[model samples]
Target: MEVPKKEDVINEMREILGNNDYIVQVVNTDNEVVNLLDQESGELQLEATANIFIGGSILDRGITIKNILCFFYGRNPKNFQQDTVLQHARMYGARKKEDMAVTRFHTSSAIYHILSRMNELDNQLREWFLQGNDQSDLNAVFVGYDKNIKPCAMQKIKVSDALTLKKQQRVLPVGMWTGSKTATKKMMAEIDHLVNESMCGQKLDADGFFYMNKDVAQQIIALIEDTYVYDEKYGNIDHKSDMRELLCALEYCTERSGGKLRAMVRTDRNMTRIRANGGFIDSPEDGRTDLKPARERALHEPVLMLLRQNGQKEETEYGNIGWNNAPFYWPVLLTQEDLAPVMFALDQRRKGKQLTIDLTEMLEGVNPDEVLKLSYAGNPIDQFGKEGTTYANAEEAAVETRWLKESVASLFIEKDEQGNWKHNPAVPFDEKNDHGVYSLNHGHFPFVLRDYKYILLRNGRNANAPLMLLELFPKDEWIIDPRGDFDEENNLLDDNGQDILLYGSDVIYDKNMNKTNFEDKSITLWYIEYPVKRVVKYKCLKK
Candidate 1:
């Protein structure tokens, strides 16, 4: 078998190659050239490859000039599977000098054309190819090829291979931090900024971002747990007591809308001594002795009365009234009507008599006219007339008069143009005058308003005894002038006849002989204002 010429083999190989095969071989040779060119030009270049096949007896006898020419003319050059002779002939021909030069030139030129197109493409899509630019355009171009063209897959595979090769040669530089502490702090600050920024835009879901950073989440959880434990251990006794008192007060206020009683007993007296002295008494000394002594102090009880109805068929078919519990030292009975049923039941049980009295009839015959007439007469009144001039003996009248005088005194508050209140003078007055009036020469005409119910008036410095001692009358006792005002209605008489209401006003008279002035007077007066009832709910602690 004669070997084929190089020119013949080159022609045969070209004839045997399909379009894809030829392009692939061309790409392979072009890739080598591109590497060489990249090194020379200090820039990247594209690469590609090509493949070819021959058939029948020509390929089996190996290649020859005649066979090569035949293959190029579209003949079945060889079927390498059926005849090794033709395959060998073609192989021998492909190695010839002329064929090598021609093959190399053809592949090289193809590569050059492909590389040129690539460079053109690179320039055309410079923005996409450049670093720091959006890679979306390049991705979009590749996606378009994948979707619209059939041979685009092969092109993409080739491009990917080229990219992999280029990336292998490229060396990435390493970075080092010059100042460790500063760089670490900067990085931490950046992380904190990012965390805060992420949290700022939305409702913070602890489970989401908080828990995403495990270390931070654990720290927060620990802090919260510690706080909860601390709170649980040291319970707030004052707050709890305050809450209870508030609730009780609210309940009392709800039950009694019109009026209520608040009582405070002075515990300074020796209660044990009094009890011991009274216990040694042989018998009731007098009718007064059976009654509790007035000196033996006891707190007043607050009571709420409510009316209830009974069925018509019952023998005592009437609305029975009762009193609700309140914060008090002793039990309280509200009205005369509330006392009748108990009295009647006790009488029946003691006497063992089954006498059924018609309560309604009995009540009707009780002569209410006399009782109503005597009601006003039995009330206590302030005897302020000539030595023994009897005033109206009515408790209600007295309380009304006192409340009126107090309310009239509370209206004036001397405020400057800026609405700021001026300070009141703090002067000690001689509390011994019989009229309960004191003279003070503290540069200002200072007058003190004392509780009329419990004032201890003194004439001069007597250290031992008050000149005119007054005691706190029960709320039901004491006269309150309904029309007394500190200004035009009931002005204080100064020597010059000018009204001397002065700067301090809005006075409160508690049962404890304490006077509270609301116009920013002495610190004592200021402190009293703090305990005043400002809201519907409150507590009264006896400290």
Candidate 2:
């Protein structure tokens, strides 16, 4: 394959951006040709303005470009490291609201999908950190299993862990024959009773789809192994193991989606066999599509589709292909894409398969016996306890730690008039529910308005909390006063001297905390704005 020259790419970019206010600079390791830095102090000597740098790996990692309104990443390696791919995300970090609106990111669909999944995984890891999970405690890092992509180099991750199916992935049985006619008939009858009798109200939809709870879905999955038989004579996927993994993925999704999933029994399909005596190949609907599935309009839910094929072999136009005369249900599980990557913790030591650490490779030239032991800075018993600091009890230590973590609400971030991001002192707010207290600020902060129901509880203390905090739901009479402004003492008030409060409703309250009859209230919040639309285009690259 012929690689395009850097000069050609630069010239093309120059032609496209021609004579604009933007400045274009080519930055690479070839400093001899185009020098932009001082030799003595290593400081950038270029003019201070909006500049676009055309370079390869040089723009990655530690490189920082302020106000990066546009980013075009096309680097595609044969293999990808999770860290290396993430570090190339130079567009991350603080930016002014105006610049952020025009910010654009261009990449291939494959790369875009990979980055989106990685972003979800990264967010999960961040939540764990925010809940005070130590690095050592985070033993399992869930990564989508791709032959080209790895979590990192094997040497980087010292431990060996078993891989599991990633979230939002589709799993279906491939290359399999059906069970005996006697067995399948019994299985079908059982399925009929289970769906119609056991699950009555949740009947089959108008489109042949049946919405079932998590337990019912599990029951349907259990019937697959008995009805669809994966012959041992042929090299086929392990039915038991695959079913278990599919169930795991289902459990993860259903738990988040209110224990609901739509199942469809797709029957009378003429799916031909792969080879003589081999199981029938999958249909197009068996695979996942970017479009949302039926019954469950929520994009963040799972779908279970069962294929009931005509179990009879005949001389077809293609060849003598089809399953045996035993109609069976082949399960295809489509997982939810919006959830965090599913990871399972497996203790290899418990199974007598411990991965021994090679000290020679790890320490290199250092003597293993003479290696000094480094202790944790904090007390081993208490996570929040620091060295030389004493607490009366564990409760006291926890309280102090919670206070320190919540201290960030004391200030809010906003952009100054010069289009620079800055922090301002925030007015304090404290609200308590069954699951401890939630502190918010009275100053403007960046926010993305989303449906309240789908929001996952990330706080550790609220791990077992309900999806919706009932008390926080807005009341009918509660309305925010649009004309309300903070007084000299930081107390929000309207023009008529009614105190503005957002605790229960958006309406103004009296000194005794009773809502007034002012129906002309409007919604007001110290909230941030986001762009209404985002455009992502795909690039089809040829070898």
Give the best candidate by lDDT: 2
Off by over 4 Å in 1: 1-380, 383-522, 526-543
Please list the C-alpha lDDT of all candidates, in the order they appear. 0.24, 0.48
- The superposed Cα distance between candidate 1 and the true structure at residue 448, in angstroms, equals 12
Weakest 10 consecutive residues, lDDT, candidate 1? 340-349
lDDT of 2: 0.48
Summarize candidate 2's per-residue lDDT along 185-264 as a digit string, tens digits.
87888876765653476655456666666787788777866676553333343333556556656765786788877776
Q: Could you report the Cα RMSD, in angstroms, for every candidate shown?
A: 45.8, 30.5
For model 1 the local lDDT of residue 384 reads 20
Model 1, 28-84: lDDT tens per residue? Answer: 343443443345444322232332333333233312222122222122111111122
- Identify the runs in model 2 with alpha carbons over 4 angstroms from their true place: 1-149, 154-169, 203-205, 237-241, 268-270, 275-280, 284-298, 315-320, 336-543
* Candidate 2 structure, TM-score to reference: 0.35
